[model samples]
Target: SDGQMPQTREHLLLARQVGVQHIVVFVNKVDTIDDPEMLELVEMEMRELLSTYGFDGDNVPVVMGSALCALEGREEEIGVKAIDKLLAAVDEYIPTPQRDLEKPFLMGVEDVFSISGRGTVVTGRVERGNLKKGDEVEIVGLNKTPLKTTVTGIEMFKKELDQAMAGDNCGILLRGIKRDDIKRGMVIAKTGTISAHTKFLASMYILTKEEGGRHSGFGEHYRPQLFIRTGDVTVVLTF
Candidate 1:
């Protein structure tokens, strides 16, 4: 399934709750606003919204683009230029995490599905280390003993790849594992890197809404979807 785009403040908050250290905000529809001052005000509002969502306004990179116009292919030159600028900003600001290849590989499963003849296929962005075709990996948190399975297939960006490195999103085909054994929100790691826990401790600040009684209760249960790494889970919050 295609990943859902976050809409509300809570949705962005949920993204942060998952393990998103860096965020890129693309403010589309700049072509609609003809006034410069009005555009500045909109930009300010965007920054404020991001700050309210637990992001540093100065740190988080925001780009102005028109996705709709770009798709229509009317103003091709302007659209391509805007896209290039956005790509440059992303490359400059987002710091890619360094991975230790020698260390154990841990991939948090973000998506899972079944194939016609290939059986179960799992896809996730690799957080650390490297995984190669024909290599054996253990599925943690699902079973007690590490089930040794061969990497039947691997793909990166629609290209058939022999291996996947850290920070690269990949789809993998397993040999022995059944569809019932593999589940979304599970981590495929090298033996012992992932630890399963029933409870976790976290520090969170409640974002105040424009409407006054939104966050009135200090200890109310807040159940929001949590995305950590490539894993998505529902976290019950008490604040």
Candidate 2:
């Protein structure tokens, strides 16, 4: 909650790009506003802002509360029950999108490390499909050749598991690949999705001035961090 806020347009665009179907806004500090009319005004303003982002007011859940007071164990006045109600409503209203697991699995590697005698370990969020122990996987990148690997082990939330579905953040052990064969920001996909060469067409927006001048255009040199499947990669953006 303390992190830098994403710009409204950027946040909405990213949420849409990632296939998010609903947005929930938890507005803390209700206790700070003593006037009931002011609270209602704030809620209306939030709804209007979210509407501008294309989220239907009827679909999104917005809750107001005082998190700090609730943490101090002052439950009744701090409105902790409101928070719980919002969570329950979300559970009922928002359904998690099902991934096309039958499609070729592709994950973006976020981190890679050595696991002593067990060999290379890669951590990534599964972007698509379900990964199970003994499933053969391939590590591919725009700049390098594809490397073959087998899932020797899988873990979710620090517990070892036999399988992981899409949307799970997992650390996987690869039996045949070396640590040098893969890198953070490469992609792990089924063999057929692997493509060679750094050039590929993509749809992208000019994110920031720091990303370089506007008419400079998209090309191999503009490698923005791309989050796809369970993998995150630095991609050379091509128009």
Candidate 3:
């Protein structure tokens, strides 16, 4: 609690690298430290570190409490009351993501499995929209021609589901897809929602050596694997 750990700083740097705009700090184990000044010192150090990493340190919410105490049902200052305060701070500070379920259904195929009696099952978390049994979906990407199939069944956590929506991590059984027709690195979406493309423009972030990344940079014509959603494809860089 005196200061942020080395791993915490590394994680913060990675978060910044990935364009994280907001953060909520939780200075846990406050009950163990008898000195209020120590807690203040920890908060000050945390804020300074946040500022160093390009975050809005002054305005960031830092909730101090003891999760162990809260779990033990303790009635101390750093117990239940502090847990409530942390939740309130999160509610006020962290903005809710605008996940619209009405958007066209899209899911990145993470894993593919072939069932002896079933045609094929693709499992992944739904990126947007909804799907139900018998809904038609298209397999797109990996520079291949798109393929269309129908959802025969849906299963999540061993339970069969009639439908799935955005953020659902489930497997959908396809009606006529062969095990070899689809694999990882493919996007399954509502028919006509997406298409396969060979090229795209993008802004890139290259991590430095100090950040546990490359020790040297590259120039044009360099071939690097570009990762998008759940797909990773190698491509040549252009000027």
Candidate 4:
């Protein structure tokens, strides 16, 4: 297997940041390696890296294989057989994410429009929970003060609806809030469920030149656009 690279490390950081609890590592290109000990070393290094990122490194599944060989249907030791083992490991290790409607309602604002006689309407896919007409919600994020508003109406495909839930792309009309007050990066959620986070600590991964990333290095003052949900806000990085 090819040894871990900078991009792999970056990916690990992102996965850990996004609350990935389990990892099934497929150590590809094992056919290129002539030494068995090298493969063992790679696995050991991978486990250590996983542990460093708050994963169950010692027990994380690691499968060695050559994807090219598997596609060509050659070398069963590092081909189809290994792929089968990898698939088995993945099926056994990764857990399905629960998409329950019982969760709090949250929708990221993607577009905002002002209705002539009604009020400001924000359109986006409902991320979780359910929202009904007259339900109070909070508009958060976009580096602005949080606004409390009532869901005066919900519409999907230009048809008025009494309620909307997770996975539905709908427009929500708010009471009292002007279209200028809401932006694309803002979020509307069940009141008091979430707050706008102006500052927080995070593990950041800067890509290397070999990964076709930044050729130059940045420092603590680097301000990069941090994208969360549908929002992208410029954030200052502290070393």
Candidate 5:
């Protein structure tokens, strides 16, 4: 646990922004404290801080432990036992991923490479559905029209596979598609399914330097550079 560090709060805010569903707080450095009353006070302070940030601090699992004890080769100092408890909590509380193999296949093209004599190979993490050998898929991205292609093969860790499902990071060989058309940020899915976002509306926080100066008073028609999902794009703000 970070106790009451500014960086800890900032990191938690970042996690919230990025759609984190669950959080497991491990309160470290319990070995340094000799007084039980002082340790309880620290936990109470941490809980208050968490509650101030709109979290269920009292309800959230806060496991106390000491990594220093573990590093010093001590097992009875509540070091490894705390870690074991955390692991058990994770398995008991955290929900497993619910992947629907019935949904249409979707995978974003992250990196494209040309394997010698293997045609155009695209690597990405599957988002939904299943992709099998000889499955027909479409490429959509880079502001270009869609092109239909077939999945010649699927591979994970150099092992050839007949199919891949959601959450699988694998390379796929597309038949008849050239490497020139393959680009990052492209979506590979069933034809007529992929939709590329053209506009974004988000509240931008002045995180870095808000000391003495507030956000820029750009009232209307403010044009700004937007760092969007995996790419940078500029957009005009219509007030």
Candidate 6:
């Protein structure tokens, strides 16, 4: 209960496996630690742990503060300085999205909805480049064969836009595509931009029984239901 939680490490590994390169570590309840040396020690340990996981530990910013104090609506408790520090760190360490207009269009469908007159609409943030009306897009990662469709319309913030670039949330209308053809987590890219893969590569770190919080260890060939976005799939393990 005192050291780093096992689940936290697992989550970081999962994030990296899924293409998350940068991370911000927020150390909460700093006011509870009275000794300065103890706080320093905590920081040192966190750096060591993060370094082991291929993260930039030395230059990485760690913001220590207490949310409970800030929630009290008074500056007397630990003050607002800690919160300010955290926000400053976020602005400094977090890199802005690189939106390249020349790059191919890519968007991960966050949600799919059925409209009365719109036929089908998929809402998501443009991951890169831009998505425009009448642009041919290929859907991948849901199944073997990719479905190709054209963007009929793009709407951002309730206003119809000719196109949406990376980092903008927009609902896109598809031509002749139904709500059933699209789902969350499926990536839509420009035609000839994405290729299907049979196997996924991962640098995974498995958990022990105690860390996994299971009564018994998972045996070989064990199958587990994997949850991704708004769907679940049962997968079998080998070796």
Each prediction's TM-score versus the true structure:
0.70, 0.76, 0.74, 0.59, 0.71, 0.70
**Model 1: ten consecutive residues of lowest lDDT:** 1-10
- Error at 109, model 4, angstroms: 0.5
* Candidate ranking (TM-score, best to worst): 2, 3, 5, 6, 1, 4
Summarize candidate 2's per-residue lDDT along 172-198 as a digit string, tens digits.
999878878887778887767757554
Least well predicted 10-residue stretch by lDDT in candidate 3: 1-10
Per-residue lDDT for 57-104 in model 5, tens only? 787677788888767768555688888888888887667878877889
Could you give candidate 6's per-residue lDDT for residues 1-239 as a string of tens digits?
15478787877666776777788887777767888888888889999888887889998898777787788756534547778877888888889867777889888888999889778888888878988789999988767788989989999889999989988989998888878888887888999998866456445456556445456667766877776543466766665
In candidate 5, list every pair of residues with a backbone clash: 1-28
- Give one clash count per candidate, in the order shown: 3, 9, 0, 0, 1, 0
Candidate 3, residues 159-236, lDDT tens digits: the string is 999999887899999988888888798989999878887777987777677766788889999999877788888999
In candidate 5 the C-alpha lDDT for residue 176 amounts to 89
lDDT of 3: 0.88
lDDT of 4 by residue, 29-73 (tens): 888899988888898998998898788998999998999999999
CA-RMSD of model 3: 3.9
**Which regions of candidate 1 fall more than 4 Å away from where they truly are?**
1-25, 40-63, 76-78, 100-102, 142-147, 209-214, 218-226, 232-239
Candidate 3 clash pair list = none
lDDT, candidate 6, residue 121? 89
Residue-wise C-alpha lDDT for candidate 1, range 80-191, written one tens digit per residue: 6678778888888888677767777878887888888887888998877898888888786545555667788998878989889887889988887888888777888865
Candidate 6 — which residues are off by over 4 angstroms? 1-3, 12-21, 31-37, 76-80, 97-103, 115-119, 140-148, 157-159, 192-232, 237-239
lDDT of every model, 2 decimals: 0.74, 0.74, 0.88, 0.87, 0.79, 0.79
